[model samples]
Target: MPGASPAALPPAERAAYGRHARTRASRSCHGWFEPAAGRPDPVDVLERQSAARLPELVPIRYGRMLESSFRFYRGAAAIMATDLGSLPHTGLTVQLCGDAHLLNFRLLASPERRLVFDINDFDETHPGPFEWDVKRLAASIVIAGRANGFTPKEQNTAVRACVKAYRRRMRDLAGMRALDVWYALDDADHIRAILSTGTHREEAVRRAGQAAARARTRTHLQAFDKLTRVTAEGRRITPDPPLITPLRDLLTDADAGLRQERQLQSLVEAYARSLSSERRHLLRRYRLVDMARKVVGVGSVGTRCWILLLLGRDEGDPLLLQAKEAQPSVLAPYTDGEQYDNQGRRVVAGQRLMQTAGDIFLGWTRVVGLDGHGRDFYVRQLWDWKGIARPDSMGPDLMALFGRLCGASLARAHARSGDPVAIAAYLGGSDHFDRALAEFAQSYADQNERDFAALTAAGQSGRITAQPM
Candidate 1:
C-alpha cells in the first residue's frame, strides 16, 4: 500500500534503478529476466545479483563432498535461494518462517514433552510474496525426492496432496474461534493419528521419543564435552578445531566489547519482564558466564549471531542461550501491522504466535554491534528438540509424506497470522497457486543451475573464495 502506483515508481527510486542498470550483473540479468523492459528478470536478477553482491558469504558450490552430512546439508542450502526468492504472486502475505523446506518441518517437544510438528526456522524472514514460501516448500520436496529416487509423477502427486491438505486446513482454521485460531497446532491427538498411519512409523516414533527426552534444558553438568575444562578462574569456552572457534579468535575490538555489554543491559531488563515470577527466580541463580559473537545458519552466513553462557552455582553447571539477529518477516510490509524497527523482535513475536510451545528463554533486545551498526536480536536455547530430516535423505514415499506435513504445518502457521478464510478463498480450492508454484520451481531450479555454474566459474577464476568441491 505504500507505493501502489502500477504506472510508475517514485522518481528518486527510478533514478537509482536506472543507475544500477549500468552495472555488469544488472545488465546481464536484464538479458534474460527482463529482456525487453530493461528490468532484470526477478528470479534471474535476484540470483545473478545475489551471487555477486553477497561476497562475504563463504560460497559453497556443487559436488562438494564433506565428511559430515550435517556440514554438507548446511552447504547445499545456498542453492535453495532460487526457489525461495522467485514466485509470481498477488502479494497477500503473512509472517513466514522463511526457510520453509520439507526437512525444516519436524517434531519438536512441547513444554509438556508431547511432540508437535511445525516450522522451525526463521532466518531469512522479510516481507515479499507468499507464493515464495509455498514454491520453496514444493521444490524442496521434489529435489529431495529425486535425490532419493522418486518418480516425477510421484513427487507431483505429493505436491498436489500437500496443496489440497493446506486448502482444507486453512478453511477449517478460518471457522475457528478467535482464541481457537491462536490455539491451533498439532495437538497430542493429531500426533497419535499420524503415528498410527504407519508411514515411516518407526522413524516418527523414535523422533517423538527423542524430542521428549531432549526437551530438557542443557544444564552445566552435561553442557561441556571432554573439550571444556573448569578451573578456579571463570568458566572459559574451549574451542573445537575447524568448526568451533573461541570468541578471542575473531573478536578484538574494544568497541565490539561495549556493544555486547549494551545488549546485555537491555536484554536483562526486557526478558526478565516476559518471564513469569517463578522463571525469573530461576534467573537469579545464574551469573553471566561468557558471551561471544557466533556464526549460524546455512543461508544466514553473514547474519549476526551471539551466544551467551550462564553459570549456575558452580562454573561447570551452566545454561547456554543464543541471541541471533532476526531478519524482518518477508510478509511484514504486505501484512497488516507496524513495521518492526528490530527484525529480531519481529521474529520472536512471530515465532511465539505460530509455534505451539516456545523456548522458555525466548526474548528480544537491541544493541549497537561490533561494526557500530545498531542491531536487534532474540535469545533462546541453542538447540531445542530440533533435528532436520535432510531432504536428500528422503525416499519417494517419505518425501511425499514430508511435503504434506510441511504443507499442513505452513497452513497452520499462516492461518494463525493471516485471515485464513481470505487466504483459502484466494487459493480457491484449486491448484492455481500450486501449479504456478511448480512451474516457478522448475524455472527457478533451472536458474539455480545457471547461477551455480556462474559462481563456480567465478570461484575457479579466483574471483571468490568458495568451499572447494
Candidate 2:
C-alpha cells in the first residue's frame, strides 16, 4: 500500500465497497420511504450539518423583501420537485458529474479542435440516484426558464421537453453497442443531430460551433497580450486590476514566495510522475510563471482554487492551469463510506473515464500547505473554450433546445461508466421516471427554499456571519 493514493484502496476492498453500494441501491427500490439504512430525516440533517459548517460554507441569506426579484430567485432549485424522498427505482449510479444543473453543460474543445458537450463541473460528484441527477437537471430548466420570464405554460413545456429528451436519449442509449456508448464522442454529429430538429435556435448553435472551432491551446502569441509584459524583461501573466494578481500579493511577498513557488514546483513534479510518458513530455516544455489564490464560482467561492500561469519561451506565451482543492464531494455523506477515500483522485479519474478526450495535463497531486494540512488537487488547462451558454440567457425556444442538448449529453456521459442499455431498460418506453422526477424536482425546490430560510434565520440571530440572499 506504499505511496498508494486514497482512491487506490486495495482491489479487494474497492470491490467490496462497490458491491455494498450496489446492494444498497437494490434495497433502495422503495426509495427514501423506508428511510436510507441508518439515515436521519433529510431536513433535520441539512439544518444540522449545513448550519454547523458555518462560514466554512456560503453564508448568504435571503434578500430584504418578500417580493423582490432576488427573493423570488432565492433558493429556487433549477427545477421544482414535489419530494425527492419518494420514488422507486434502481440505484444504478456512478460518480455523477455532480451538480448537473442546466448551466453546467458546456462546450469544450478536444485536442483535435472538435467541440464536445459534457459536464464541466465535478466538485459534488459521487454515487447516488441517477434519478437525483435528472431531477436536478429538470428543476434547473424550470427555475432558469422562469428567470427568463417564460410563461408558466412555456416553462412547463421547456421542463417537459428536457425530461422527454432524456427519456428519448435513454431509449437510444439502451440500443447502443457497448463500445459505441463507451467511445461515443459528443462531436459535430451529436450537436448537428440535436440542432437539425429545430430552426429557431440555429443562430445560437452556429455561434457555439464558431466558439468551439476557435478553441485551442493557449498559445504564446495570442495569449501573451492577456498574460504578461516583456517591457525589456521576462514573461508572465500580467496582473490585472481586480481578478488576476501576482502570487506575491496574495500568498506572500518577495522571494519568500519564490521559496513557496519551489515547493509547488516539487509538488507539480511529484504530480507529473503520476501521468503517462506522453503527458510528462508535454509538461516538460512549460514552467510555472505565476500563481494566485483566486476565488472562483458562487458555491465554490471559499474553496481553495489557484490559477497558475505557465509559460514556454516568454511572458506573452501563456498557459493557465487551475489547481483546485478537491475536497470530498457533497454527496459523500449520503453515500457514507461507499466511495473512493481519496476524493481528489475520484474526481480526476472520473473525469478522465467520463470525458472522451480530457486535457493532456490532467493530473492529481497531494501537497501540504503552509498550514501543514495536506490537500489534494487535480490540475488542468484553465480555459479552452470550455464555455457554457448562460441558463438565464435563453428565451423559451432556445431554452428548450438547450435542455434537450443537456439531457442527451448527460445520458451520453453517464453511459461512459454505467451500462446505458441497462439504464435505458430501467427507464423503459414510458415517462414514469420523468413524471417522478418532476415531482422530486418540485419537492426539492421546496426543500431548498426551507434550507435557504434556515440559513437566513441562523444568520439573523447572530448565530452565523452571512451575506443576504
Candidate 3:
C-alpha cells in the first residue's frame, strides 16, 4: 500500500488504513513524555538559533521569553520539536503550524472583509505529523492554565475540552464532501452562533461580539495613524528607538542608506511580481514612503522584520505592510525537508493550504545585498483586523471555552490538508485519545517549567544577556 494513494482509496479502506496505523503507535502511547537520555540543553538550542539572528536583538528575545513559563513555551518551538521527534508518532501528516501555541490562534480579516478565527502565524509551518500541532496546542493550554492559577483538575478539563473538540470536529469533517470540507470556514458570526449554545451563552456571545468589533477597528488606516507622524518632507514612520527604528536611522553612512533604500524598493518590486495582476495593479497605486525595522512577538523578536509604509492616493490614504524574515521551519529537521527553495515560498504555500481565506497581499521575495547578505521574506498587510487573546486574564470556564474554539479551528486547518477520514477513524468515538492528550499536556508543562528555569540560570550566569524592551 506504500505506492497507493490514500485519497484514492474508498472511504472504508482509508478508515481501515487508519485503524491499522494504531499497530505502529497506539493511542494511549501519546500519554507518555520523558526527556530522552542526554537530551540537548534547552538554552544551548536557543543559543544556536540566536547565532543566525541580529546579535543586538537576541537579548530582547531572551528578555521576552523570560517573562513567564507560558512565554518561554512560546519561544521554545525548536526545543519541543526535538523532544517530539524522539517520540512515536501516528504518521498522519499535515501542513503543521510548527508552533501552534494558544496565542497563535486569533481572529483575522478574510479577503472578503469578514473576520474569521484561524491560525495567524506560519513561520514554523511545514509538513509533519498532525499530532505535533495538537500536542503543541494542548501543552500551551496547560501552561496557560497554570499561569492563570488554575487547579490541576481545571487544567485537565481545558485540555480535554480542546482534544474532544478536535476529535468531534474531525469526525464531522470526515463525513463531508471533499469540496465542502475545503470551502468550510469559521467566521465571527458562526463563532458567535456556536458560543450562543454554550452554558454561558450570553456572556460568551457578548465577548465574541466585542472581540469582533475591536478587530474591525484594527485596520491599516488605524495603524498608519498610530505609527506615523507628519514631517516637513512628508508623513513618515515615527521612530521608537530599539523597538521600531526607521531605515535612515539604522544606516549611519549616507551612501549605505541610499543603497539599502534602493534594495528595499527592489524587494517590493520582486514581491509584487508574486501577486496576481489585479493585486499588482492595486499595489502600484501606492508608493513606498518609509520602512522601519520592528521587533515583534515573543519568539520573533530577533528576526529581521520590516514595516513598510506606503501612500496610496494621498497623505490620508495609506497602506502598511510587514516583510518578515522566514527561516527554515523548526519542524524541518524532524520531518522531510521543505519542497520550496525559498523559505518564504514555503511559508506562503503552507499558509494558503491551511487557511480558508488568506491575506490578499500575501506574497514572498528574496532580498540580496540588503544588509551585506541575502534573506527570504514573506510580505503581508501589517494590520488587517487582527484580534489577539489574553489567556492570563481568562477564568477556568473561559479558558475551556477558548480551548474548544482553538481545537475546532485547528481540526479544520488539518482537514484541509490531511486525511480527516483516517484521523476520525483513529480518534474513534470515545474519550481515550482526549484523556491521553490531557495527561501528556500536564507532563509537558512540567518539562516546560524546567526548561524555563534553565534559561533563567543562563541569564543569571551572564552566559546570555536579557534586555527588557
Candidate 4:
C-alpha cells in the first residue's frame, strides 16, 4: 500500500481499505475536538501574512474580520490550518478549498452562460484531507448560524443537514461512472429545487430567479459603465481612493511610471501564454486601457489586487480582469507545499480541477512589486455574472438550505480528487458521522468564539489596528 493511489484502487479494494481505516481511526475520532496545546496564535499568523501584503491596507483586513465572530472565522483560515493539521485524518486527500466557509459557496455564470453553484475562492486551495474541508464547512455553518441567532437546536439541525447532504452526495458520486462524476454539475435550478421545501420556498425561488437575471446583466459592459468614465484620451478608471486607486497616482516619477507600465504589459503577455491559443486570440481583441488597486474580501484585503480595464472593439466594448496576488496556501506549512513553483498557477489548476466550468480568461502571471520583489498572481474576468448570498439576509431555514448546498458542492469537488467510493464506504449508510460532525461543529464553534474574543481584545489593547469600512 506504500504507493497506492486513490484513483487506481478498485472499488472493492478501496471500500475494504476505507473500512480498515475506520477500524484504526474510529468513527468517534472524527468527532474528537479540542484546541491543540501550543496552537499557533491567530494574530501572529495574520501579522505574518500582512508582511507580504500592502501595509496601508492591513488595517482594513483586520477591521473586516473584527465585524463579527463569523467574519473572524472566515478570515482565520491560517489559524484553523494549524489546528486541523494536528487532528486525526484518514490520509485521504482532495483539492481542498482550504477556506470552505459557508459564504465562499456562490452562484456564477459558467462558460455556457448557465449559472452554477460551486466553491468561489482558491487563494488557499491545495491537496489535503477531504475531511478537513468537510470539517471547515461544518464549523463555518455553526458559526454563521450562531451569528444569525439561531437556537442551539436550530444550529445543530443546520450542521446535521450539511453533513448529511455531504454524506449522501458523496455516496451518490461513489456509485457513478468516472465520466459521469466528472460531468456532474450543480446548476441554479438544482439549487432552487433543494431550497424549495423550506418555509421560505417562494421567496427563495423568487430571489434565485432575480439573482440569475441580475448575474446575466453583470457583464463587462456593465462594469465598464459603472467604474470608468469617457475621458479625453479614452475611457479611464475613475479614481476612488483607498478602495480603487490607479497605479499612476501612486508612482510619481515619470521614468519609474513608464517602467511600471512596461512591466504590467509584460505581465499580461505572460498571463496570455497560460491560456489556450483560442482564448489568447480572443484576448488580443482588447487593449489594456487602465488598472487600479482594488480592495476585495475579508482575508484578501491587504494582498496586492488590481483590476485591469481593457477596451475591446469600440467604446461600448470592455473587459475587466482581476490580478490578485497568490501566496503559499495556509495549509502549506502543515502539509507539503505546492508542486508548481508559481502559486498563481497552483490556484488556477486547483480551480480548474474542482470547478465544473471556469472563466475562459483564467491564467497566471508574475509581477514585480513596487518593492522590487516578484509575486505570483492569477488573472480572471472580474465580473463574469457573479452573485453571492448575504448570510445576514437569510432566515434559519434558508441558512440551513444554504448549508446543504455548500455540503453537496464540497462533496462534488472532493469526489473529483479523492476516492469517492472509499469515502462513501467510510461514511456508510448511516447518520453516525452526521451526529459526530454536529458535535465537532459545536465544539469548534466554541473555540471560534474564544478565538474571536481574543482577537477583539487584541484590537482593543492596540495589539492589532482596525479601520472599519
State candidate 1's TM-score. Answer: 0.75
Q: Which is the leading candidate under TM-score?
A: 3
TM-scores for the candidates: 0.75, 0.79, 0.98, 0.97
| Model 3 C-alpha lDDT per residue in residues 1-469, reported as the tens digit of each score | 3557667999999898787778877899999999999899999999999998999999999999999999999999999999999999988888899999999999999998988999999999999888999999999999999999999999999999999999999999999999999998998766876676657777777787888889999999899999999999899999998999999999999999999999999999999999999999999999999999999998888889999999988999999999999999988988984578889999999999999869999999999965577899999999899998889988888888889999999999999998999989988999988999999999999999999999999999999999876
Task: Indicate which candidate wins on lDDT.
Answer: 3
lDDT of 1 at 83: 29
Q: How accurate is candidate 4 locally (lDDT)?
A: 0.87
lDDT of 1 by residue, 210-321 (tens): 5445544323345544335554665666665223445555547877756656656566666666667887788778777565555465545445565677778776567777
Count of backbone collisions in candidate 3: 0
Cα RMSD (Å) per model?
9.0, 6.9, 1.1, 1.5
User: After best superposition, candidate 2 residue 332: deviation in angstroms?
Assistant: 1.5
Winner on lDDT between 2 and 3 is 3
- 2 or 3: which has the higher TM-score? 3
Instruction: Please count the clashing residue pairs in each candidate, in the order shown.
Output: 11, 20, 0, 0
Residue 238 lDDT (model 3): 98
Put down candidate 4 lDDT per residue, 1-469, tens digits, no spaces. 4377766877899888777768656666878899888877878878888888888999999999999998889899988998899988876667898999988888877899888989899999999878889899999988888888889889889888899999999999999999999999999667877878878788878877887788788887788888889889888988888989897897899988888888888888999999999999999999998888899999899998889988888878888999999998999877753488899999999999898869999999998855689899999998877777788877778778888889999999999877898888888898998998888999999998988888898899999999998
